[model samples]
Target: MLGALLWGVVAASSLTLGALLALGRRWSDRVIGGVLAFGAGALISSVAFELSEEGTRTAGPLPVAIGLAVGALSFYLATRALERIGRRGGGGTAGLPLALGALLDGVPEQAVLGIGIASGEGVSIALLVAIFVSNLPEGIGSASDLLKAGRSRRVVLGLWLAVSVACALATIGGYGAAQVAGPGFSGVVDGFAAGALLVMLVDSMIPEAREKAGEIAGLLTVLGFAVGAGLSVLG
Candidate 1:
């Protein structure tokens, strides 16, 4: 449990780090977009090698398939709800959607981390790096938008800090839950995370990256995927 908690914190710390970096200086859209593209690619690798493959190995395909469909739908509905709320609230809260995305993405990702720990598989270095890498762009982009929208630095920092704490705690929660759940549960959890991540990538990250960075984003994404896949192979 302690190990899971610590690993979670380590993974989530990048959020704070990215927030600080964003607050410290202005980043060009190209740079931010490039980072997002790279992160998206890394996440894809994680979904493929870490989550889906492992889930299939652990508990076959049925539970994972159900989990995938459920998770994808859940994320879509939740994101739409958040968008509606943000629209009603006005443009002053432009950053809310991205922040919400980060929260939604973080929870299951870290939960799966905890599940891995409970399964005695130790920490997956590939997944950890992917999560950390992906979170950086989320923090940076969200904080930057919030600041541009005239939010106080304190509020932006506080929001991300809260998100970080919540995500970190999820790791502990997942670890505890996995201890009592059947083995099939881990596969479901893995599929759930993968589904959410896939939706997020398509819905927001990829399009945004392309809009900001142009065609170069594609190359960066492929490069990021290769790097993540290499790490998984080595691990």
Candidate 2:
């Protein structure tokens, strides 16, 4: 449990780092987009190799399928709801969905970390690094937008900090769930996270990256995927 907590914190620490960077300087849309592309690539590898593969291996096809469907639907609905709320809250809260999006993304990833540890697989270096790298752009982009929307620095930083704590606890929760569940059940959990993550990439990460980076974003995404996959292979 302690190990899981530590690993979760290490992965999520990048959120704070990105927030700090956002507070320090205004980054160009192109730079932010490039970072988003790279992170999106890393997340793609994680979902494909780390989460989905392991999920299928642990439980087989049916559970993974069910988990995937549920995860995707849940995220879609939740994001839509957040968007509605943001719209109602006025232009100043445009970043609310983005901030919530980051939190939503982190939950499943951190939970998977705990699940892996509890399953006796220990920590997945590839997954951890992917989440960490992905989170930086999320934090920076979201924080910058929030600041632009007139959010105070304290509120922006506080939001990231709060989410960080939640993610750490989520890791512990996953570990506990594993203790009480079978391999098949844990596989479902893993699949669920992967499903949610993939949807998130499509819904926000990829689009946001593309909007900023243009055609070059594709190449950068591939590069990011290669880097993430290499790390997975090395690990």
Candidate 3:
């Protein structure tokens, strides 16, 4: 839990950097889109090379697949609910679904990092650090999207704070659960997280990049994927 809470600070801090850039009114959609594309690729690849690799070895692909399906479905359901709420006049709904969905998705995964720490601090730190890096584009993208919608800084900051706190608390809970559950627990958690990320990469990042960042930017996305994958070799 402590680890996750700390990561919350990291995530918030990373976002803060992006937030400042946004406040300066110097945001670039192309840069963000490109980076997000790369991040999406990195995340998807990370699952195949890392998460699933570990998960299947620990338990079996079945349990992992089950968790992945659950996570993906959770995202789908949440998105549907958000769409309904937006249609009902959720205020600034037009430009906010993707960002909101990310907020919903990322919080628990960070908490899972906290849970993983209970068993292995080294492992927890590595995973948290990696996810933190990944969250960089996410934070920037959300802030940029809200800014483009002309949201007030007060509103943006407030929303961000609320989301961050909820994420931290959830991380604590997830970590606690994993601590009690034993080995297979991490695999299950990883499966769910990777699944959700996979969905995001495919459903959100790719389309967004193609529309905003163009092909060159898309290649950077691949580069980021390779770099993220290479990190495992260092470990």
| lDDT at residue 26 of model 3 (Cα atoms) | 56
lDDT of 2 by residue, 1-235 (tens): 8999999889889988988999999988899889889888887888788778878888897888887888788778888887777678764444555566567657767888898999788888878887888788788888887887788999899998998889878899889888988777766776777777788789777888899989999999999899889888876
Query: Could you estimate the TM-score for every candidate?
Result: 0.94, 0.93, 0.85
What TM-score would candidate 3 get against the native? 0.85
For model 1, what is the alpha-carbon lDDT of residue 168? Answer: 95
The per-candidate count of clashes, in order, stands at: 0, 0, 3
Whole-model lDDT values for every prediction: 0.85, 0.82, 0.65
Comparison by lDDT, 2 against 3, better one? 2
Model 3, backbone clash pairs (residues 3+ apart or across chains), number? 3
Flag regions of model 2 displaced more than 4 Å.
none
Looking at model 2, residue 148 earns an lDDT score of 79
lDDT of 2: 0.82
Model 1 alpha-carbon miss at residue 178, Å: 1.5
What lDDT is reached at residue 31 by model 1?
91
lDDT of 3 by residue, 7-44 (tens): 66675455445455556665677877876777666665
RMSD of each: 1.6, 1.6, 2.6
Clashing pairs in 2: none
